[model samples]
Target: MENRPDKTNKNNRTMKEKIRFYIILTLILVTGILIIQTILKPIPQGITGVQTLETGKQQSTQNSITGLGFLQPQDIHQIDTCIGDLSSTGAINPGDTVELKQDIYVGSTDCLNIDIANITLDCKHHKIIGNSSSSANGIVSNKTNDATVKGIIRNCHFYNFTNKTSIYTGKPIVLKEGAKYFLIHNNTFNVTRGITLNKTIDVTIANNTFANYSTLLTLYTDAEIYINGNLTNQTNETTIYNNTFEGIGISTNKPYAIYAIYANDLTIQGNTILTSNQITLDGVHDFYLKENALSRVEIKSQSSNTTAGRIERNTYIDTSTAMHFTSFSPNELSNISIYKHDMVNFSLSTMGSGVEQIKIYNNTFAGPMSIDLGSANNCTIWNNTFYPDEQTQITTGPNSKVRNNRIQNGIFKTITVTGDNTTVENNIFTKITGRGIVVKANNATVRNNTFNNITGIAIIIGDDTWQPPSHPVNVNGTTVYNNTIYLWVNLTTNTTMHSLLTGLPAIPGASTGIMIMPNTNNTNISENNINEQNIYAQTPPNMLKAETRGIFGKGINATYTLENLWIHDNTINTIREGITVENCQTTHIWNNNITKAGKTGIKTENCRGTRVNNNILEGGTYSPNIILWYKTGIEIFKSRAEIIQNNKIDKYHTGVYIYNATNTTSINSTINQTQIGIFSFLSMNNKILNSTITTRHIGINLLKTNHTQVNNSNIRNETGYLNTTGIQLSLSFY
Candidate 1:
């Protein structure tokens, strides 16, 4: 009877605890039921929901459908058998996707014809194999004249269509007229021809690999065509970017990786092309070609205008002709700019007329090149560096400017300006083996140029040939001023063999500073510093065939004469001849300082109305190694109406030698430190007045001269030899 009262209380407490445990169990069971229901129930499309499945894996239920349960028979058409004819199944409708189950073999006519819009054909990595006798395509759209058919064909393998009898034979895909908004991607084409898009619009072909095809893709009359990351061939309002082109075509005669004809608004960029051919553009305008690695590029305008383009920062490697611009007619081709390019073994050739406003700057050329601006106007070439192994030529047009360029180790004429109103200034020419700058135009100003270690003529003015009808167009009104010409004849020994083997003209050991060619008129050569250095002869005597002079003005053989030439305030040092004027008329040479001349300081032959005034002509000590055949300070031969006045002539074999001259006068001139002071041979009517002549042998020696008078002159013989005479007249005719 002791625990009987506590038994009731214990029972009541246990009952309450049992109620709480039952409630907890019921809640747990309801939560498990709700989770199972959520996992099994379907989720709405594109709505995010989390659920744990029976496999204990959490997954997002947003637009997630597993298995093939959701595919309707009308939406997905399975291709189990080979297609022989397309008319049996009618056209593929919109929102339909055809899946390839097995490899299909097609007949010769039509495999799958599509004339409807918004259809997709996926091959599921199965090949569409064609028979050798078949000329059918894997997919083709019929011609919709005024209507557009949009479709997509992807993940298809086209193989072994070997028939090439016709142009359309062996083509895998053909999009006919009025096809728009079609996407062809991730396909492999191994047939004879890949795809053809004719009159298509807004087509994108990407991520396709084409191998061993005649042409990977051909586009005709298509606009807004975007090609990216594909290996294909030949586009307007077109973009060709990030594509790799291997070869040109099946036939080796085809030389274009991509050819666009009558295209407009094209953008070609980021292409890596490996072919011996070029990318060609014909009748194209408003183009941008940038950031490409290409072999060559060609632009041609025929019956249309190609205007306003840019070619920037593209690399050309191991190509022969990098860029070529041509026009069939004069059609105002204008506004082209090319800058910041790295070129190797390349050139630029622009031909035909009506080309204007071109700019080329900041390019580095490693190998030899030729930049020809044929008949182009208003062009600018600046800040280019050239390291050429062979001959390099840069020819400019009218109103062109070539400034601030550095030419290193060029073998031939570096720059040539044949157009009028051209300016060549501030150019640095170093180690040039041939002529540096050649100007054959009128009204040219070549100033502030530095030529160092040149082996040939530093600057040449006037034409070399006068092939009749192109008569020697005089280099009239030309000024060559403030030029620094330093010719190092010692550096030209190795170049002789190269010149001889290539049949190039030999560069003279005694190179010319400036050469004014025959019939040059009104030329002014002033303030030039020419240093020849009197370099020794390293080649054979027979091979040394160049006439050396510091400044030479030449004329045709008494027919065409150089007129109105002025050479003043120039300094010449260690040269063969300081200045040589031949067959010139009305020439004035004044205030020049010449030193260490190996031969005549100032020589004029067959000149008329010549004046040599206030010049210092000094010859160095005679060396037996040098060929001193004509070591005279002032030599005048066969000249008429010549005046030699107020000149200081010294350190020569003969101070003044006048031969076969008429009406010659030497007044107020000082001649000293010579063997013979004033020597005349076969001269007539020459007057020597108010002159000081000091020599060791003879003062005034006249042989076979007529009517020569010597008045008011002082004569002194320093050596005082046994037969020294002040005024000896021998064989005087009158």
Candidate 2:
């Protein structure tokens, strides 16, 4: 063109080379339309463009294809198999996090069959091993109505496995029904049967460590199980706190560590159970068993309606029976409360008839206890501290109240009241061998008690050879008041003072402070204070038997009749017969104050309308030479309409003694230093009026007499010896 710039600049250099060839053809057609728009853009749903090629082969690249692609070759061979490699059975979705590095030997039947929900099976502490061929379960979820399977199973280690198919089948972890919000924390179970919740809902099994399981935990009809901290076991609003159950009950025959059935609102607190036998509750409702360290506890209610049950502060060891309340129908077990326990080899049994309001308070017992309120009504056993070995019975409950108890070393009959309006008040019975308080029922009340070293009968009302005196089980209006009975007798035992001195058919020693036998009607032995010390009269291969007595009323073969009986204001000491009435009727031995009478100080036999009034007999006879074997200070036999008034007898062999008595009457009595003072035998229409007799031998003695009357008598002989007498008649009539 320069030649044409000469030529017109060579046509403008061919138009600047045709404008550089149309700008190189417009940058090659805009780089071929940006490589065909990056080859048609779109690839993302669980990712794919296939490129993982480090040698495990898979390459389809375009440049930005991130992972989990190639149609999931078994989820990329289980993410290259190693970290909790569960490759056989699947389906763990919705934000899954399955982490368990080793130990996993599930032999089928359910190693892990938790269907599909918001999963997280982090058994990071490994072990989910189980293989007993088929009836197995390591971690299961049946999913009944579908609570949408929510989950979290942490630090797991479940072992063994044996579910012989019956007895609710050996479980290792089963959440049935509508499985919801499950969180089984820090697990470590040595399974034979541990954890089973049927009908589940929002469960939380915390800090678990259940060993050698038989039934470490089981709850049928489950609702809200929130078991806290280490070891576990309960239902419908359950809360088991601080658990530690170590069982050897061999995995279920009847071996229960905790087996709650048909539960309602159960709460078991601070557990430390080492089981071999029982801890079962059937048809449980509103239960709260606190501070436990148990061996036995059974509460069975057949049809529900079990109300507010509470077993408090427990610590029972080596138990045969610590707690048992069984009901099959009726009201189905009502409100129960057992408080502050510390029992050892204890016993408590309540059966059927829908047990009512029960309250066993402040307990601390060691060894024997047999409390059976079979037909329980409003029961209350107060402030207990019993150390009974044998007869520790508190049976028959109605409006029961065994008050303020502290019974120690009891062998038999510590508290036996057949229960009508039962109230054994303020008790403190020590070292009893038998009978401290035995009221056969009927408005019962033995008040303010304190009996020490009792061998038998400190208070025994009615038992005329065991109740059936012509169909009269009457211990009517029974009340033995203000008691304080002490029978030392040098701690008693010539075989128990010869069995209280030869007891059988009548008495050698039935050891009585208060013993009202027969039908015992309107009975009331008032203000008692009996103290018997070293009462001696024992020639026991035969003889020496004067019916050892101290306030005793007998009538066994006479077809029972001890009516309107009231022995009043008693203070008897060193006795061997001080107030003894036989077939009593309208009997009232009044204002008693007798001391050291080893034989008789108010004795009546075959009594009629008897009354020995204003008594004050002192230091009489201990069988002084046994003549007619008379050791008397007012003794009447075959009595009828008898009344010995204003008595004051001192140092006697015989004073006011009547035999075969008929219309007997000894008025205004005062006899002192007597061998015999006003003594009538074979008496018919007797009367010793205004008596003031003093004698060492005989002041007024009548033998084999009839129609006797010694009027306005004041006879004294002060024993000048050699047949001394102021008036002595033999085989005569006056």
Candidate 3:
């Protein structure tokens, strides 16, 4: 502005001065924008520091630099790339090496053609790496074998850019077989291809960045192939390495890392892959994947994939398990040798899931609540350490042989029943929070097992703690037998939480020790030592469910029946309910020690044809156990005919209460308790015979019941609820 050039004086300056001014202005504006944007869109505060970038430069040139229509013939006479004319360079002769200088611009239809032989039109490779300023690309040489040129061109960038052409087809720097020893090295390829070695061999394409090229690969599309799958013969001994791939073709797809079809003597190592898709595809024939550490590598299977490749000692770490692999066709046409590996460890404390074929023989685990397993094949587990965090360890589907395993400081429960026909024999299951063995499966043999320091809520009243969810996902028939279970609910809900303890009664954690829903039937229990007071202090016994609702709304009086149930030989030290048969038919309960009961021994509501016989009923002497017959005239939601036979009953309060179940038959069972021995309210068709009774109250009292036969039975009391009469006869049943 100070000394503005006059209109006439501006003509004195040379044209070079104007061009230099424009270039300087462009650089100034770029520098200003870089400074302003750097402030306005400030750099992000990463964990460490800002990432550093690397940079380099390259220059390319070709022969025949000068044209035939040169205004000054002498200034641009030489064939050096220093000349700048192509159309007028005249035809190339045999043995002529065409050198492409740094500035050789070709128009859309303009191509360098050669009809001569023994010519070398080469592109000496120059690299524009990912560490370069932005995504950079350079040059391409398509058809140069038969003549016009011979010689190498180095340091020319190769990229599929459209500085001149506007077509959507990406620009490619090609090299056909006619070109040999085409030393193409040190080039950066991003969003473009460097040199597609088609029908070419002995090519060296190294130290290049094929960056973000395989971007549009789809489920059915196989893009980003460095060379054609069928053209491996072109680059038989090719070498590709030290490249970082971060395109969609690299995402979750493991086959795009390094692909060499039928290629020989290939080596790939030291590559880092960080794709959101967790996998990269790498294919090689007799290939080597050594030191090629991957976040995730996917091995693919081809239609005619029969060659067994080698996979040796590659470390893979996946945090989210997003890393995946596909069988090389079928079952991988190969086997991999992993010297050492690690599965990402996390807290697996959540319980009650359905898993499969997981063998936990003799290993220390962090936390896995419910793990299902298949039949063990020649696998034996002995002397291992187990620590539980949930109420149950395993739920279903396995045949695990666990013997002599050291279980220490566990929580909730050690194992649970989830699947069908499994065997758990001779395992020490002791922990705090839940019962040692919680049965929820069918045909399960639980024998020779010891349980200590278990987790049970209370003793006096059952079901005082938290109950199970009403809606069960997968619950079926189960058999419980011959295992010592020591429960200590006083510790806490489970092992995960030790400071906060739930001191409720009635074995709080799960709804019922064994819940039988509609889909669950034909269940049996025998010979298991289940102690519940070690967990909860002075806990009450629960007769049925801790808290019943919904499907439990159908709990004791459910319309659905649990058929073919056999409850026998179970030593119930303290529990909510011993033999609770609800909506079941033809249930047989026999020879179970209902001593030291928590709430009650046997409870049957809406049950039909139940036979209970031959059991020692002792120190339940403190609690008044009731056997209420909730039978109705209607067949639906009603119970029928229950027989209590030949058992030494010793308890407090009372013996059996038959209510509404009119046709119940009680025979051959001894009774000795505090209050009444046998009391009936609207019960009928019962036979009381050959049984001794000793109690503080009535011997036999019938209130609104009939059709019973009493013979060969010794009964002595203070007139047996004399209010009813000396020999009472009532008609409640027709």
Candidate 4:
């Protein structure tokens, strides 16, 4: 009321105020509309929009995903979706690419069921986790019988998933029925069951990790990789390369790391598996498993075709049993080669039904090896090495060969031959506690083998009923030639050759350099050097025995006789008898040089039709424990129909002692420097013809004997003793 005098001026000022208020309101409305329009606008297609860029990430407009998700570089559709949304959307279309954005929490429902082909699902390093108690799977393919899904699934991380099915289902990633030509690579799986393939072909699994974790608690996680293919539809051309499997617990239900059945042309290369489970293969053919670090391998391939299988360049570490092979049925398995393996602590076992041409070469065993290849024909083991303080047992089958192997520091182990026509050649055995080689089969040849410091028998040719009662047949037609046996003796106790021969035993266990036992016939032992005189200078003795022989041809009893033995061209220097053949018939002992024989040399007792010719017996200091009757150059006791010809006997107590022998002839023989020459005791129909006998005491002696003749013989006794005679006959009729 005070300012009501100027109405026009007040009205004009009010109008100006109203105009300013309208302008402010209009500006606020325009700003709000602009903000709404900017927020509501759709992002452009074929472009990836990000508010902020990461360190190694770049803004791109080509709609392509990288890092194991590169299907087609240009036509790649990078779908930024979670793992749960892919399952909700049923099936990813063909030629579509889906990249997960966040970690997916899986429930009882399956995560991804791929039904279409040519799809790429990249998890992008996010974990697809299951509920701690759920029986859900991470990813599964189509279950149809004729659907072929060809796709690439890469860069996934799956954890805490457990399966409910009993038959290799509901795994972390499963390709089933007709899932073929797929690539699954660069995935990380933890605390979950691994991948499974059923009746698939041309699938490659590379650079994946299947590990066990302790954080999640679940059930029914059995095998790491299980591939099942039946007879009608077999899986083919599967490759698993450059993968790692760690801390995989063995399942008592189905304990295996990689189990395959009826698969062909498979390759498992460059893998590191650290578990106690087995890599079992059944009904597989034409495969290569190379360059792997494994624990165990069991093969039961039923392949009959001539295509080959190979397991090469593998390292087995810290396992009890490394490899086992069995059940190749119907026809023989063709050409399996196992070479270049390094076994830390393991055993290899094999059972042969239909297996042939199995070659094991260039391997090293750091511990003990128990190899039992049962009756496998044409098997070869060559160029292998066995380490110290370990035992090894190798049993060969028919037509098998063991060559060029170095087995050292063994504790009571041997290579046994059980089948026919086996050959053991060029092997080096050092510091062995048992027999170096045992022959129990027919036509087996042991040649060019060197035995050094063996505590037991160097080579034994016997039938069944030996220590190991598994041999079924008698040994026949066996030839052991060109073998060098050096028995070590104690150097500290042996100051002279006399002390070395008497004090310490050369061969331990009272064993011989070559022993031929009962039921062994048609044997040939030739060109062998037994118990070298200088063995003690090289190695010291570890043990002692009662006696040692160079070559012993033994028999069971008087009823069972060893027949048809030919022992020739052997050089034996031992502490006891050299070349003793007892209870034998139709035997030939010829051209042997017995040097440093402490007792009798070339002894034949209870034998018939024996021929000993061209033998050189050079005796040394007698054994203090042996009796006087046993210290002879050539002993023929209780034998008949014998022919001893062209033998050179020297430096013995008695040369040619014949006891209880009949129809024996010593023709063209020479005796030198002996105490008694041609001493015949209780012998009948014996003749010494064309013989030159020289003795220190008696030249020719006959005691309690009849029908003895000395024709064209030169007998000389050169001694100063009182009762020295050139020829003495006492209590005998001639």
What's the TM-score of every candidate structure? Answer: 0.73, 0.41, 0.50, 0.79
Per-residue lDDT over 1-734 for candidate 1, one digit per residue giving the tens place of the 0 to 100 score: 99998999999999999999999999999999999999986543432111112232223231122221122213455675554433245423354566787888777676777665555667888998866675676688774654445566778988876554543454677766566666676787665455665545555555565554454334321111212111121222455555555543545454455565555566678766665546776656688888888878877666466677888888775367788887677566677888888777768888777777778889887778888887788888999888887789898988999999998898878899888889999999888887888888988889999988888778988875454334687788788999999876753354553243222455446467898887789999999999864444212342134345688887765767889999999998877678988999999999999886767889889999999999998877643365544678898899999999999988777888999999999888898877788889999999988879877678888999999888999988765445567887889866
Model 3 agreement with the true structure over 1-734: per-residue lDDT tens digits: 65666754676566668889999999999999989977885333431211212112222243232221111111121121211122234433333444443333333431333233323344344222221222221233344454332233334454434222322333334445454444443444454233444444444544555455454443321323244334234344444455455443443433344444434444455554444332332333444454544554443434223123333344443333322223332322222221222222211211112212223343443343333332212123345456645433543344544466655555555555444566666777555443345444455555677756544311101111223534333334455567666554433232322111121243334323333444345666677656654423224433332321100101323444456777778776554444465667777778877555444556677878888788665544253345322211101113577777886776635566566674566677677643666666666666767767765556666667767666776665533443322233454443
How far does residue 94 in candidate 4 sit from its true spot (Å)? 4.6
- Tens-digit per-residue lDDT, 397-431, candidate 2: 76788888888777767666776778888888887
| lDDT digits (tens) for residues 309-336 of candidate 4 | 7989887864677887775566455477
RMSD for each of the candidates: 9.0, 20.0, 20.6, 11.2
Per-model CA lDDT versus the true structure:
0.72, 0.67, 0.44, 0.74
Candidate 1 Cα lDDT to native: 0.72
So what's the TM-score on candidate 4?
0.79
lDDT, residue 567, candidate 2: 86
By TM-score, the better pick of 1 and 4 is 4
Candidate 4 local distance difference test against the native: 0.74
**Top-down TM-score ranking:** 4, 1, 3, 2
Best by lDDT: 4
